[model samples]
Target: MTASPEIQEIAIVTGASTGIGAATARELARQGFHVLAGVRRDVDAEAIRATGIEPLILDITNPEHIQALATRVQGDSQGRAVRALVNNAAIQANVPIEAFALDQWRAMFEVNLFGQVAVTQTLLPALIASRGRIINISSVGGKVAMAAYGPYAATKFAFEAVSDSLRRELSPHGVHVIVIEPGAVRTAMLGRAIATAGELVSAMTPEQRQRYGALVHAVNEQAISSTKSGVPAQAAATVIAKAIAARKPRTRYTVGREAALLTMVRFLPDRVLDRVLAAALRPHYPKLPSVYDA
Candidate 1:
């Protein structure tokens, strides 16, 4: 590897505030890398500093920030090349297909898919120079669709394809590209998803609300329980950091039990999978009055 920054390999981890992103940033720092922590909020700078990592104010959706990052990594007179880029920032907004909002869908993609791409492309030259790796943090949702998670799943699926193409294209240049697909972990996003679902269901017509009330409740309960019981974000981050540090990294790293199972489910017959999903996600609707009963 061609080294530029004297303080070990300089690693840039985006969304380094809390959860997996934060854990990964800390792990990288512990591994003796000069870590550049990227977060949208200035308040998070202290959190990164606490981990002994340098903080950069970066909102993936901001074009100016992307440009600045690219310029900085390209180096000035001294010439410093970033050795690794961990695209760990993402957002999950659940929007059931039937009632999906275009604005929310676009917002999710802006952060989860488009934002990652903007940063990656901006820093590609430096990555190529260092023969570094790019780790795109995806999710199991990307591989399989579930009810009420259409928007999030769609973006993740897109991320998977994007990562795959980058891996193929960059392999010859000694740049490794890998993806991390973590299962549900206890995070703020999970709670937000539940709240969003409740809001959506509440706004529906009384009849429609009645139709989906039970189903929505069931989903919310499941989500809350899973958040409580899910793999800790730190565990997932460990797997991700390993992926970045390994000399021969795998193309994909899946964390959590459900993440692994979903990969297998990908091979099941389409009809079988569809039926399974229906059972899991079909909303409960009360039976209409029959003419005989009336």
Candidate 2:
């Protein structure tokens, strides 16, 4: 049964506290959808509360929050059909695979990958009932994993795979599952990642530090440079909105030129790609004393 013309459709965006998530929530609301913006704190909830946008306290990792979100959607007072679910909550840290502890790796996956899965699973029933869209926010890292981005990239890669599988499975059910691959967007996420990397570097043993210290520094510098030149979160949100609104949306959409180019070249031979990535990092590495200089 189709929703009445007067009933506003609902769109849910996780991680609506900041960056792409927040921008998408505002954009969706402006487009006339009643957006359920998921934030983790009361402060964020209050900040995002506005006309057509209702903020809910949601930590995607918490089962209680997920269940509450499901209940809220199912029991909407207006009986609005859910239109879209944007899974955007994620965290990142730049630490080498060897230096990152196993528990830390698990923690990253719990939020970045598993949390997203849990949310999607909970909402699939409503999404399928309404023939809605599921938009997964991936990254350029989903296609190309640079040095010191192992754990984060792994989660994105896994998400990319899950998106593909879910898309195929749901296509027959009139549900669209889309993936958005965004390059470095000018967001606070990069600053937080750099700080986390700094903490991880300090915790490394002497041998581990010696092995990965320069590499971590280079990665951080490169990230800062890329973020400075990156597109605004609004640009990504625009793309996401387009995908959600399209009658026949593509399975994947890239947010920026950098994301498009990188995802395109991800098929290059491994050795060649390695050289290219290494060259990109070389300029950011700290200068080292040579024997001649000594």
Candidate 3:
């Protein structure tokens, strides 16, 4: 059923306490949607409330919190049958695939993949009733592989697949599924990734460290600098809000410089693309033996 023009649009945005999630929630509110900002802690809830959006305490992994969110949305006239569900929560720790702990992988997938699925499942009926949209915030890594980001990107690739299947399955129900691939945004996630890389390096065997040291250091420096230079969180959020609000949003939206450029690289010849990526990341080796600085 087509919703009324005056149906009073409502939205639920996970990971809404900071960065992209917080910005998206505020932008949606500015667009006149009643937004439920899903946050994890009391401080974050308070912070979100300060923006004049209702903040709900939500830890995506916890079933009770999910239940509470479902119950609340199911009951509120102003907020029920939400018109949009923005899945923006994710956790990234840069452990290598070989050295990555099974439990850590499970935990990342729990919040990044399973938790999102559980939340979407709980709200699917309401979303279908309202002919709503589901927006999954993925990453450039979802489309391209990287050395140390396998665990995080694995979840995003899963999310992309989820969005595709959902778009096909829910079209008959008048529900739309959109995936947003953001290349880089200024957020704490990068800091966490860098810290995780450091931790992993410290715990590595000498041979392992020797093999990966220069490359890891280069990546760490790149991540730190990029965190400062990447597009602001608000820019990404604005794009997401646009995708959600438009009547005919694209199935996938790629945001930021890296996302746009790297996606184009996918169409290039394999040998050319390989050379480009390798050159971009390869560490500089001295042409001649270096003398030690006294």
lDDT of 2 by residue, 1-294 (tens): 222348789999999999999999998888888999999999999999998899999998899999999999999998888999999999999999998999999998999999999999999999999999999999999999989999999999999999999999999999999999999799988988998988888888878877888888889889899889999999999999999988889999998788999997889999999999999999988788321111
What's the residue-level lDDT of 234 in candidate 2?
A: 97
| Local lDDT at 24 for model 2 | 94
Look at candidate 2 and give me any clashing residue pairs.
none
TM-score of 1: 0.88
Backbone collision count in every prediction?
A: 0, 0, 0
Q: Each prediction's Cα lDDT score?
A: 0.79, 0.91, 0.82
TM-score of each: 0.88, 0.95, 0.90
Best by lDDT: 2
Residue range with the least summed lDDT across 10 consecutive positions in model 1: 285-294
Candidate 3: count the clashes: 0
Per-residue lDDT of candidate 3, residues 38-105 (tens digit): 99899998887843379999999999999999998888965545889999988887656776778889
- Of 1 and 2, the candidate ahead on TM-score is 2
**What lDDT score is found at residue 108 in candidate 3?**
90
User: Which residue pairs in model 1 clash with each other?
Assistant: none
Candidate 3 — which residues are off by over 4 angstroms?
1-7, 77-80, 269-271, 283-294
True-structure lDDT of candidate 3: 0.82
Scanning candidate 2 in windows of ten residues, the lowest lDDT window is 285-294
Instruction: Report residue 145 deviation for candidate 3 (angstroms).
Output: 0.8
